[model samples]
Target: MATINSSIVIISLPAIFKGIGLNPLEPGNVSYLLWILMGYMLVTAVFVVTFGRLGDIYGRVKIYNIGFIVFTAGSIALALDPYSAGAGAMWLIVWRVVQGVGGAMLFANSTAILTDAFPVNKRGFALGINQVAAIAGSFIGLIVGGLLAVVDWRAVFFVSVPIGIIGTIWSYKSLHEVGTSTKSSVDWPGNITFAVGLTAVLAGITYGIQPYGGMTMGWLNPWVLAAIIGGLALLVVFVMIELRVANPMFNMHLFKIRAFTSGIFAGLLAAIGRGGLQFMLIIWLQGIWLPLHGYSYEDTPLWAGIYLLPITIGFLIAGPLSGALSDRFGARAFATTGLLLNAATFLALLVIPVNFEYWEFALITGLSGIGSGLFSSPNRTAIMNSVPANQRGSASGMAGAALNAGSSLSIGVFFSLMIAGLSSSLPGAMTAGLSQNGVPANIAAQIGQTPPVGSLFAAFLGYNPIESLLGPTGVLGSLSAQNSATLTGQTFFPELLSGPFHDGLVLVFVVAAAMSVIAAVMSITRGSRYVHVEEAVPEKGASVPQPSTRSV
Candidate 1:
């Protein structure tokens, strides 16, 4: 439920914005759009490690149960939102942060719980199923959100309530911690620096994509630079603090494990590519392909999700099997090969036209999914297995943090790359298309001058790009009905978009492929299959466990 809710709101954004009485694609409102999309992720990314450390100091199961309760409460609050416009958006954002806190708890500790439940050799299969379930939830959430949000926007939030409730009950009733715990005081300085620093960095990146003054992106903005630079400075301080502190929130020494460190880096890169792909595909499907194929704007979200099922099929096929196989064969080969395959898929995507055949699109994306499944579990197993038993909670948290952070970063990195591509080409296309479709040259130029991010957001949120572009200026109303219909028709905007969107796709996919390839390089360098040796704890005194690897 935690992971599923992450993507659910994305597909349902059209209904959500409409229900809240806000135009998210408008220049002034774009920040709201970004925050709504990224806030939960940003919050979760920053705090997962802290919660993981807390789980270590306290108990994993106890923290996880609390997460379910908090998450359900947040869902209820979201469903019951009583305001409209910005106030309503704020309400949702605040509650979403609440949900994020709960999500971090669950994400950080769930792996530790799984590791505790499973033996060493079987850990790969268990983690595989768990990781697959999480990724599947993200994919499935798109379809579920579209269906529920169509009936009522609130239904999207309401849907999580019952599931959260059931999960809460089940976790509390059945889960008991069997894993070792570290009895240490909370590292307050480390916690404060890490949370605040990572939050600043991620939030800065999130806002960095928004327009500032005359620039298409806020990279030039003083505030953005400050946030990013200041965040980095604090992170440096965080590292120093962690090294000196007796009980650090994140164990700095964990980086010594080649498998764990490499897995985290490779996984983080893969996540950036994967998360960016999700958003890009959503825009591609909802903005261009579905409408071009004659689906109504309102129906695009649901259909887009449906079209993405082939990717999930690929995941279902590869995830568990790879996990089981990696247990015997070692993770290095599977993890490296999977990402290399994903890189090939990225290259494949670049060659496909913007208006691609469904089957061709499916085949490429299915291969991408297979690549993801092949890497996810084995990488996770390697990370978990490479850490000492007592640090499992922290290890899990770090892994979760890497995943969420990569996802959060994708919004900035991929979108900025696409925005750069669009900035160069989209203006001419928008101007020419609008002018030809009965809009005045001056007005068309003005609309064309608007940042390309708006167009991307409009399409991503399932709004007809031309309608949103022309509606406010009354250009559509002024034109002859036939001309207006033609401009707003299924075909015009997508056809107008095809060339420029293709340029954007090339930029985005090329970067994504490069990331996958680099991640593959990282995966291959992780040495061999090995699990960390566990030391027996003495009954009375503190046990100093040696951190050493044992080939499994």
Candidate 2:
């Protein structure tokens, strides 16, 4: 449910915006759209480490059980939102942040719980299933959201109610704490610094993609610069505090373990690449491809989700098999090979045309998914296994933090890249197209000069780009009816956008491919299978084998 909620809101955004009487693409509402899209992720990234430490100090089952209740309540609140327009968006964003809090708790401890229950040899398979569910849930949510939003926007939130209730009850009744608990005081200073610093950095990145001061992006905005630099400074302070503290929120010592450190770095890189790919593909399908093929803007979201099923199928097929094999053959080979395959697929996607055949798109995406699945499970298992039993919760939390942070970072980085690419060519093309359609040259130039971010949002939210751009200016009312009709037709904006959008897509995919290649290198350097073993000392004063850190 947590994982599903992370992505369901994305596909249902159009319905939610419509139901709330707001246009997400409008200048006033783009922040709302961005916040709704990224707030949950940011909060989750900021809090997962703290929550994971709480689980270690208290109990994993206890924290997880409470999370279910919190999550269900947040879902109920979202469905019962009473306001419209900005108030409505604020209501949902607040509740979504609450939901993220719940999600952080679940994400932080689930792997620790699994590690406690499964034997070392079987841990990979167990973690594989859990990892697959988390990853696949995002894709599944897209389809589910599309289906549910068709009935009612509220149904997207409502769908989680019954499942949450049942899961909460079942978890409380059946789950037990099996991992060793550590009694340590919370590192309050470390927590505060880490949370504030990370949140500031991420929030800065989020806003940095917006247009400001007549520039294409807000990177030069005073507040954004301050936030990012100040945040990094605070994070450095956080690390210092952690090193000095008796009980750190994150055990910095764990980085000394090559398996733990390298696996985490690889996972972070992979997540950034994967997150960028998902959003880019959605835009490709909904904004351009589906509309060109005769689907209405309103219908594109549903079909986009449907068309992406092959990727999900690939994950389902490869996750368990590789995970099981990794248990015996070691994680380094499987995880490294998976990342290489992932990089290959990204390069393949780069070569594919913007309006490529469905079969080709599906085949490449499926291969990418397979690569992701193979890497995710084994890398996660290796990280968990490298840690001592008492540090499982912390280790798991660190892993979750890496994934969430990478995802949030990806949105800011990749969107900016795409926006930059579009900004270079879109304005002239838009002006030419609009002028040719009988719009006054001055008005066409004015609309064309609008930042490409708005158009990108329009495309992302399945809105009629021409209508949204012209409606507020009242230009459509002034134009001849035939001209207006032509302007608002499904094909005009998309057809004009195809070339510029392809330029952006090429840039985005190339960067993603590079990140994947770097990730593969990190994965390869993680070394062979190495699990930390605790040997009991004999009472007869016999020498016990010290825990070996050597590769198997």
Give one digit per residue, the lDDT tens place, for model 2 in 1-552.
787887788888999999999877767888899999999989999999888889999999999998899889989999999999999999999999998999999999999999999988899999999989988888888899888878999999999989889989999999999888999899999999999999999999989999998998999999999999999999999999989999999899999999999999999999888888888888888888898899987787788889989889998888888888888988988888888888889789878888889999999999988998889999999999998878889899999999999889988999999999899899999999999988889989998998998888777777668887787778888889888888998888788888999889878888888888898888888888989876666678787777655566
Candidate 2's TM-score: 0.98
* Residue-by-residue lDDT tens digits, candidate 1, 186-303: 9999999999999989988888888899989999899999999999999999999999999999899999889999999999999999999999999999988898898998898789
Model 1 alpha-carbon drift over 4 Å, by segment: 471-474, 536-547
Name the runs in model 2 displaced over 4 angstroms: 537-550
- Which 10-residue span in candidate 2 carries the lowest summed lDDT? 543-552
Global lDDT scores for all candidate models: 0.90, 0.89
TM-score of 1: 0.97
Instruction: For each candidate, give its TM-score against the true structure.
Output: 0.97, 0.98
